[model samples]
Target: MLKERLYYIDSYCKTFTTRVVKESLDNMGNWNVVLENTAFYPTGGGQPHDMGLLNGIQVTNVEEIDGEIYHTVAERLDPTGEVEGVIDWGRRFDHMQQHAGQHILTAAFVELFGFPTVSFHLGKELCSIDIDVEDVSAEQLEAAESLANEIVLRNLPIETKWVTETELDQYSLRKNVAVTDEIRLVIIPEYDYNGCGGTHPSSTGQVSAIKILSTEKQKRKVRVYFACGGRVLQQLQRKNYFLAEASQQLSAPEDSVNTAITKLLETNRTLEKALDEAREALLSFEAKDLLLNKERGIVKAVFKGRTVKELQKLARLLVAEADDVIVLLVAETEDRLQFVAARGAAVEMSMKQVSASALLAINGKGGGNDAFVQGGGERTMAGEELMNKMLVSFNLDI
Candidate 1:
C-alpha cells in the first residue's frame, strides 16, 4: 500500500502537518530544498503551484519529483523546526472549480453522444478536453452543453477512489492506461469514470454552470474549451453588462434587442453591397475612359493617399479588356507606396529609369517587367505625373 500522506484529507485541504522527508543541497550549493510528507498542489498540469509557507519559511514552489514532494522555499528553515504546510486554499479551490467543471462537461459528451474524453489539459488561463470525433455539429454540441448544465443543477456528488490493478479490471473500464498499483479514479456518477490525480470539487452542483466556449480540431479529435462555476458566473455578468450597454446604445428593448440588431446588420449589409456594386461600375467606366483617352495608346492609373489592392484589380481588368495592352496602377499608404504593372511589353521600364523619372516625378517609390515593372517614389501631390514620367522611359508620351 502507498504510505504517502493525502493532503486532501477526505475534503478540501487548507493546512497540513508533515515530517520533513529529506534535505538536499543544490548543484550551485546556494539553495536548499526540504522534502515533506504532505504539500499543497504543485505547479503541474499547467496550473500554478500553491504559494504560502512551510514552517514560515515562505514556500516559493512545490514539486512532486519522483514519488516524493519537495517544497522550495525562499529562506532556509531551522532543520529542527516542525514543517507546517499551509496552502492558498482560495486559489486551490478556484482551480478545483475549473477541474471539476471539466469532468461535468466532458462526461456530458460521453453520456449524450458516446464520445470519449480522449485527453485533457488544465492551462493557467483556461482548460481544455479533447474528444475523438470527425464532425461536431453545432446542434449536437448544444445538446451536450444543455445536459452538462442539467448535471450542474442536479449537483451529483463527485467521488475519488484508490483502486488496485485487479480492482480496475472489475469495472469494465474504457480502454486501459498505464497506471500504478494504486489508481485514482474520478467518478462522475452515471456520466464518466476516468483516472485522474487532480483536485476537484465535492459535487457537480458546486459548479453552478458550464459553457463550452469553443471547439477546435486537434488531429483526430476535437478540443473543447470551457469555463465553469464561479468563472461562468463572471462570464455571464460580463456578457449581460455588454448586452445591456448595446441595448441602450441602439435604443432597443432587451428581449427584442437581438432581433433588432440582426435586422440592422442585414440592412447595413444590403446597403453596403449595393454601394460596392455602384462603386465598381463607376470605376469600370473611368477605366474604360482612361484606355480610350490615352494620348500614346497606353492606359495608366495612380491613386494617392491610400493603400488598397482594389486599384490593382481594376488595372488588370482594364488591361484584359483593352487592346494596346499596358496597364499600370500605384497606391501610397502612410508608411509606404506600392505599384502593380501589367500588359504588353511593360518590362522595358527598368527600376532606375522608372524611379528617376516616372515614380520620382510623383515623389513615391516602386517598379517591375518587360510587360510589368514597379518602383517606389517619395510622396507628392501628383501621382498621375509619376505615371506620365514612367511612360516617358518607354519612349511613349501621354
Candidate 2:
C-alpha cells in the first residue's frame, strides 16, 4: 500500500477531509480505521489522540496498531465509501496547551538541575513526568516549578523542525533519540530540542500558564505532576469563584480571607483549651463515683460508650490513685467495643489475650502486650450486657 501523506505534518493544518481506507475493531472493542491520509494525530508521545469527526460522526479516538494508524469513529461508517475526517479544534488546542507547557517544564528541569525527564504520562487529572533523580525535596521541587513558571511568564518563542540525522550532527538532542534516522524535533527556541512525534503549538507564548500540583517519590524515581495552560486557568477561575463567595459572606477581600481565618482559628483554639481543662477537672470529680469496691481484690471502673481518648485519660488518673494498681478502661462507639487495661506491677495482665477476647466478642480484632489487657467483642450486646460479660470473663469488679 502507498503510504498516505500525514496531514499532521503541518501542525497548523486542523481541517482536512480524507477517504477512509480501511476500518476494523480489535478484541478490546476499539475501532481502528486507516485513512487514505489523516490530519488526526494518533495517541503518542504522552499526548492523547487528536479527536474530531469522520463523515459527521464524532471521532473519539485515534491509535496505531502494528505500524498502521487507525481512527475510531463514533458510529460505524461505510467501509467501502469515502469518509471525511475532521480534527476537533477545541480538543486539539487543549492538548497542545498541555503538550507545549510540558515541553517547556521538562526542559526547565534539565536546564536548572541537570536531571532529564525519563518519561511523561498525560492524563485528565494531572500530567505526570518522571525525572532521573533521587528524591526531590519540597524546596527543590519548588525551585524547578518556580523556574517552569518563570519560563511560562517569559513566553519564549517555540519552534518545531524536522532534521535528518546527518544535518543535526552539530546540535545536541535533549535525550537519546530512539530513532535519529528521521526525527521531528520540537524546539523551544534557545530552550530545548527533543524528538517528539506529537503535535504542538507554534510557540510557547500560547501556553498562558503552568502550575505544579505536587510531587511524590515512586521507588527510586521522583514523579512530578503538574497542570498547564487551560487547565491552570480553569483551576484559577474556580478558585476565584469560591474566593469571591467567601469574601462576600465573610465581608473581607479574597486576599485577606485566609489570614483572617487563621487568626480566628488561633483564638478559638485558646478558648477550646480552657473549656477542655475545666471539663477535665469536673470529670475527675465524677470519676470518683465510678470507684470499684475491693472485696476478693479487683479494682474496676464503669464507663459508657465513650471515646478512647476520654477512657485512656480516666485510666491514667485511676492508676495514679490506686495502691494495688490494675485499671481496666471500657468504651464503645457506635457498634464497636474498645477496652484499655493497664496494670503497673500490681497484677498480672496479658494485653494480647484481653484484646483477643474483646475482638472475638465484637467480631473484630485487637491486641496488646503484657501489663495491659483489652478486649472488645461484637456490639450485639447493649452497654450493660457488654460491661457484664467483660467483668465476668476478666474477673473484675464492675
User: Could you estimate the TM-score for every candidate?
Assistant: 0.73, 0.78
* Tens digit of per-residue lDDT, candidate 2, span 235-266: 77887899999888778888899987888789
Task: Kindly report which residue stretches of model 1 are placed more than 4 angstroms away from their true locations once superposed.
Answer: 1-11, 17-34, 45-48, 51-63, 67-85, 123-126, 137-139, 146-155, 188-191, 216-220, 281-302, 317-322, 344-398
Q: Pick the candidate with the highest TM-score.
A: 2
Candidate 1 lDDT by residue in tens digits, 90-185: 677778888888777777787778888877777655678888897688988899889889988887888887888878875645546467777878
On the 0 to 100 scale, the lDDT of residue 116 in model 2 is 83
**lDDT scores for all predictions?**
0.70, 0.73
Q: After the best TM-score superposition of candidate 1, give how far the Cα of residue 328 lies from its true spot, in angstroms.
A: 3.1
lDDT of 1 at 57: 71
Error of 2 at 35 (Å): 3.8
